[model samples]
Target: MGFFDLKAECAICNKQVGLHRFQIANKEWVCPECFKKCGFTAMTPIKTMTASQVQAALQEKEKSAEALKTFVATKKSDHF
Candidate 1:
């Protein structure tokens, strides 16, 4: 078997995730692309989130991005 043959399918995208895979709380592996959609940083909660929660977070991310398009800053910070 080749190096790529050891890849497993991502729980979310169903894509072949290679060695660099993220295992979620439920023990499901997620692909790099799908994990990017999560936008999670180096936080403990990320490791506790299930595949469904990650999917929900992705949806929320999309909605938040859409909402930000029309966001207006009414007040500016006095100090940086």
Candidate 2:
């Protein structure tokens, strides 16, 4: 009967997620922390993704972050 009673468990982190959460295609909830790690935005079609897809997206984001760390700009281009 309380707000906390409606909380859902995150499929990835297994933590209790608040009302402001994301639901996957299979209806499993995702916590804010895990959502942030996936780098998803409001424009992302997350509702159509499965839990495994979400996990894959998170792993892809981590790889992209690691790759970015070693990236260097060899040339700067200016467009008028």
- TM-score for each predicted model, relative to the true structure: 0.74, 0.79
Stretches of model 1 off by over 4 angstroms after superposition? 1-5, 74-80
Candidate 2, 1-80: lDDT as tens digits: 23345778888889987787888887788888999999998888988999999999999999999999999999888985
- C-alpha local distance difference test of each model: 0.78, 0.86
Q: Which stretches of candidate 2 lie over 4 Å from their true place?
A: 1-5, 78-80
Backbone clashes counted, model 2: 0
Clashing pairs for predicted structure model 2, backbone only: none
Best by TM-score: 2
